[model samples]
Target: MEPEYWDKNPFKATAKAFPPGFHYRPTTLNKTRKFYEFILVDTNSVSIKHFKDPKDPNLNTHSTIQILKVMQPRHYGSNLNQPKKFSAPFDPTRYTYWDYIDAWTNVFWHQNNKYKHSWLIYFKNNTTYNFPNWFLQWWNYFGPIPQIYPEEVQQGFNQFSRMFNNQESRIPADLMYFSSFALSWIFSWQYRYGKIENKFDNSKAALDQVKNWFQVHPEFLKPADPETSLFLNKKSQLAIFLAGSKSKEILAKNLKEVLHLLQQQEEEEKPSKKKVESSDENDDQDDDPFYQNEDDCFGISLEED
Candidate 1:
């Protein structure tokens, strides 16, 4: 039988078209308006049709190949609802299929909607399965999957940081610095309030990472430049404030010392107004001796006499 006929009439006409004694009955459990499922009588053979309207005999079958070419045999007992037990206890050393499920689901949830399609393509091209593991894992978690573990997030952050650091030629240094700064602040806030138990500790750890980044690249926090220093100071103050009540005092103290150092550096780099005025006066005196020794009542230099 031609697949196009099957696509046009689905199981409706296919069951009747089959030779006499061939048993086929539609299964209701998996049947939907757009999809039809049928099983052979006295046999385990089953077929699913992605048909919108079986009554329309002229329905286009152009996309039918796309659906049929990828269809795999559905093993009845291997459904996701059926739990499997392994002989040995769960092993952390070797990952089962489930680990990839959790990892990919967490990635999908964290990505922006626009970027999600790229993730879909990446998984489709890279993995053996057409769908991501997380889609199945979602049912096991009983709700939306938990945010990725902190260690995984930290690893991602570090990897991005390294990538940004290496792209100096492609991206401007200042833009990279600002991007990292914004990312650090965002991550710090998320760590504090993203339903983590150790909110304060995680937030502080995130801020500490930002602090270390600034320490390594001091030019990004140039005290003499108001443009750079203003943002640096604001970020530091915000980070300290977000450190929670417990660590507020310690963070405040450390931040105060940093600001004090910046102030001192600013002062040392700037020329004093009084020194400039004094130098100008000395130049005037050297140009005209009379200006320095205001000769008695005549404003004439004694040396000229």
Candidate 2:
């Protein structure tokens, strides 16, 4: 039996019949003939290849693993411009965010280059960005971040934001904290409705840290009185509570309700039902005017955008 068409030329065999969520752009580097760059449009992942053999023009026969690079969308002519941050160059190996974190832990803590530590070192050398002191402290204290569940990352980010008043340089400790809490909530829910996985060392340590913080600052755990509680909808509540001269205690007081709500939902949800989490991080690219009038099909460009 013949293989599927998508398997034959997954990228642009025909002008209009390529796979969804993927894009192809023709390129030229040196005298390389008929070179093309395949891109995962959604993830901004890119892979470049040169087709030397006419029999294997389509990438279906090519090696899947190559130099993979992350592409940052460039705004050619718009006010939506910001200083460039360090972006990893084309790497021969494909790495996930987890791998990056692991390598970072090994390199930063042990001063060991045993792992694939190039990414972090490259980032540090190329960028002029200043990370927060607290963020650096968190990484130093926890070495490798603990394994986090897919479901709890958002909640962890939110809780962490509340704790730090939505600072741009906030640590992912809260996010990791929620991953640690995953077991408790899963068991708690399973006992009532239905159930959940691994306990990483760093995750456990993070849980302990959060617990110690709460123990020292018990007032944050206290519920705010409804009568005098601030009336806040989504728009202004975060701004008022998480970004200002307000104290951490006051921020925690306001965020207390959200924590309760998350816990309560686990009990409320029926067995086999999955909770859909809306992403809090928004990409400013969509709102940028640069892409508003430009063609989506990006051709080859040797120079930087």
Candidate 3:
């Protein structure tokens, strides 16, 4: 369904044939060969209609998009079977959001076009839920999902956080995923487009901002699973510390302390590092601390005992 904000925009449709539930335009890459359609199903998901023939919009495949994670732009291309990998020279820089329920649902569009398509519907279903294990594992190993735009995520979350702040009140379970998905959408097209594409530095800067937000609202990281919630908090903190140590500028007050703590950790784990180093030169992937046992990893011990 179209968001209420569409009625206030200039591209708001006036034609009688145009329904409120459908997008004003198609969102696919090939306008001639394909006719892709989108409709906002709910706050946390969208219904997709993929038409192979431009002449036959009615004859199409149906799918649903439930956003799981959002980050730099990447696509599976025309051959949908291939895995998505970020290649150089990313065109039309924007946050590419991944779907939890469906893989083929991934797409990128100009913010205005997305606005026309009503990418998000402002509806909250007062239900509670938890994230899938695979979803958590994928992001954790790859890299922590940086909050490039905390304000936007916070704004989207405020709708629920504010209402649920009262005693005995609570946010819907589904909103937790929505809050995570909201982080991906909050980005600057102009800044990202104009600046040199330094993914590491920009991501670190954005994540540094997240530390402030986390301090203000630790509940944002609290999922249903206590272990999972703790893991997420630790993962984010570890990612920030790792990013800060490699950077030239001081990110936050705690960063230096965290770096010193990391030094102590390195010193304590010198023997283990030596073993890992001597294991095999071919075992490059093993360098990632995320793959280590979570229970005993330095990541889990970032916070003071």
Per-residue alpha-carbon lDDT of candidate 2 for residues 1-305, written as tens digits (9 for 90 to 100): 12343445322333244222222221212111111121121133323222233554432221121212222223112322432222343322233332222222222211011211111111111122223333355334432233323334334434443554223324344433332332222211011211113432224324345556455544344334543443333435656645653787877876786677656866786442432222222335556667554675467586887
Ranking by lDDT: 3, 1, 2
- Superposing every Cα of model 1 onto the true structure, what RMSD results? 21.7
Candidate ordering by TM-score (highest first): 3, 2, 1
Query: How many clashes does the backbone of model 1 have?
Result: 0
Candidate number of the best lDDT: 3
Index of the highest-TM-score prediction: 3
Residues 1-305, model 1: lDDT tens digits? 66654655344545456433222332232222122111120121122222232555444221110111112224323453443343344322122233222322232222121221111010011112222323333323322122533553355444335534342233333224323432211111111212223332333225456557657665443244566767777777767665644676877786687778769967985677668888998898878967756555585556853
The lDDT, on a scale of 0 to 1, for candidate 3 is 0.37
Error of 1 at 156 (Å): 29
lDDT of 3 at 101: 21
Worst 10 residues of 1 by lDDT: 117-126
- What are the Cα lDDT values of the candidates? 0.36, 0.33, 0.37
- Winner on lDDT between 1 and 3 is 3
Q: Which 10-residue window of candidate 3 scores lowest in summed lDDT? A: 31-40
What lDDT does candidate 1 reach at residue 246? Answer: 64
